[model samples]
Target: MSSVVVVVVGGGASGLTAALELKKSASAYYTSPITVLVMEASSRLGGRILPCDVPVEYESIGGGVLYERVQLGAEYVHGGEHLLDVFLSQKNIKRIPACVAAQGDGGPSGFQESQATVAYYCGKRKTFIRFQPDNTSSTEPWLANLNAHLRSLADDSNATSSAATTGKSVADGLPRDSFSREMADAGYGNTLAAGSCTLLDEGETRIMEVAWDKQASGDATPEGGMSRVIEELAADVCDAIRLNHYVHTIARDAETNRIRVGYVASYAHPDDANSAVPEEHANEILVDAVIYTGSLPSLAHVDVSPPLPKVVIEAARGSSHSPVAFASEAIKAAVIVRGCPYGEDSDTDLHAVICSNSLWPEISFRRAKVGDNLWVCGGFVSGTCAEDLKSACISRAGAARWRNETCVVLLEQLDSMFGDGGKGWRASAGQLIGDHDAEVVPPSNRVVGAAAYAWGSDPHARGGYTFPRLPGASHVRASLNAALWPDVRAPPFFLAGEACGDDDGAPMTVHAAMESGRRAARRAIASIAGRGTLQSRM
Candidate 1:
């Protein structure tokens, strides 16, 4: 068989970007055109770009993924500037700043929400320090910043539990008497667990072990929603795209090192009725290279020949596959009969109200552009976002929400926050470019404990981006980026994904994923094109 240059598996941003780059760059190296195949478990191409189909008036009522004024997922992006520049530049899209300092009461929002915390060894009950701020003119709206400072301090392995121990550290700056006293009482130690942070023991708690340190300086992102980020990338090869194609597995022959891939045909059994061969089975493809870009839950379905390496199987199984969630027991619609509240002047900082349980959402300005003119403008809500925001993002606050409109209610999980203190906020549908506005009403249901955004629950991305609990990180990049001489003989199976690399120990973000894809493509070119790891480029 004449080898295939690359087989890209994922259909997400990274996979698509890699395939696009490989298709364009690989031609220069190979005598024969390098063929690239993108295998996705789902039928559609936008892996996590599912947008809300709600109403523009919901902005006044509170519902949206990324308001035209604030960026959500990719909102607070930092390190991947170069990466951002390339994609945005290629797509002719412009990026805007979305970060600002504490805009509320100067005293720490002075409020905090307490979360369920379990002491690892002691098994003692201490709360994870969370905030339940009064988004009104109570205190320093810098609640997010203050908490961040505390987190940075908490992340410091050497950060003395007591200022006396480390002699004037971040702990010293904390207003022990002001508000975080509650957290201080709960105590701080390496033998602790917070959120999704899983440590391999105290040794892993070392300062450098886990740093929120992004590659480059991170800044507030698009107020225009990050969904547009993935959209623009797709525009490049949208023509070469296929939707609703579910891949069942990959078949391989160990003896000859030959491989065949399969997919679930849309219309099958009927055509092969009463026949030994059903055309509806997996659609197989034989090529020089293969790449899988689906999520972990999706990976469970791929059929690799002779079985995947034991190590690979074990690691994949062990890795945590969860989604970015937003839960609310009651979906409240706060419509001010008088004025719209948003931007600089308002107390909520104009961002969505994502409560501790995903209330009072503080998304970036960059995401706002994506909004279809649904942001609540002017004035402010007097009371805390409690009535409408609630303790969580689980259900609609009223019967009207569920009965009057459409919504998928998720409950019993932690709200996942990205770079900042936002409770994992998702999308809410709105009006189009020029559409009629609708009345706003809050949901009748209210969440008690947790309103999680479980991406694992989402059919699209088996789970959210990769986390670090699973093993094989160091070996991740190598396997995905490896290439062999097919003419020389051997079963070639290379892998690349944020799940596959170290990325200097950061969790799976868009940055790490894209980098892994490039590494894989470059490796294919060098070995097959007969070039070694060339300087810088590779």
Candidate 2:
């Protein structure tokens, strides 16, 4: 009996997990050795899970090299269950409950002094309304609108097929997913409203609302960062990963009944700079099965000879081509700043500041694990689609310039909220940012450094995450996950990623992506085992 050669493409969370799962199951599930290969397009793994170091001074905590590990993606453990939370628990990792502070739009102060409060900024009147969740009467109107929206969404889900055939857009649906409209009607601006609706699907939005109601929060990163999970997962499959291998094509080899994968060497090894290997020259590999964990956009661009089933192609195409429909684009900016902005007697324990403005819907500030003087503050900006958001991060001036602009905006907002009434802190912040025409704006001592990234701009990623808009998306995902016709003599091929799940309860999440990979790996194994059993019988 020959070993089954399985190739996992895209060494992100899903691909790595699939490879690890397949390796761990070698003895239990197969009679022969199973060879697993993980091909990553980028020089590094972890996909959208990016972590960077922010310098912090640790004078209070014994004065060591204290730097805060800030996460640029997948920050929270949503619901605190599933494989991610379990892994964290097993590793004895700690999760910090996020506390939120919000300032109403056009409020006298850009930020409020109170913590754990929800402030709605009225774009029309330019006033802020602070809502107390405990006050049933005050919150009844918003709750009513939310309940109504959910009912409408449920109705739309039931009638989606008929509506789609009738040429109805998502806007025509019963619930209609107008988060901004709903929020604006409730006196809050489109900033928070759009932010919520754009990031999550209808079902996910509902779940989040429930979680918010409970106030029983999910956890943020452990002390260092969320990269530990990636490091651990990659460690298990490190030997199998082929970094900087950009897969451009996947084809079925009719003669050998194997899958032919074509990829180009995307980068140069530091030691082999003198080597004359052309990066453009395509390399080929033959595998018994393939688990594609690449992004939807990357999958769309791949040349599939003897095209995949129409359903699979349609699903991938729908995800990639429809930039405005299914997915959301976002830019995250992290700024390293000095001084204590909010706390008791200038010692603020504030973790996050939710804004009603469009520039930064939410700004989070967290103290460094080791450094008492350093803090990392980040703001998330949601755009209408891929192009809109990508431009904000990847500008003609370059990412660094965009990052500086974003940080400047953040500092300005902070000046409004925390400034000493246009004198004390504001004067210091202006000096730090420097004048607009200064050619090179030096960061004042108060502002250490700033960095920004838009995941949609990444060559491999092409988008932040999946957010299925219409009801038909589930069917498409199911088709993508389904194996090709068993009667066909083609090679075994499977699709797995954040966008490959059919479950509405768990979609567009790290755990869901991992689950999808595990499922795909199992299917690939079963296909191989079934073929082996049939060959033996023959």
**Which one wins on lDDT?**
2
TM-score of each: 0.58, 0.75
lDDT of 2 by residue, 285-364 (tens): 88888899987656767777777776556555654444213333556777766656553244444443444433565566
**Alpha-carbon RMSD, candidate 2:** 6.8
Q: Where in model 2 is the C-alpha error above 4 Å? A: 56-66, 99-132, 135-223, 266-282, 314-328, 343-354, 385-400, 417-445, 484-491, 502-506, 533-538
Candidate 2 local distance difference test against the native: 0.57
Local accuracy of candidate 1 as per-residue lDDT tens digits, 89-189: 56665554322212211122112211111110111221222234443223433344445555454466552212123223333455654333222211221
Please tell me which predicted candidate would have the highest TM-score against the true structure.
2
CA lDDT of 214 in candidate 1?
32
Candidate 1 lDDT score at position 40: 53
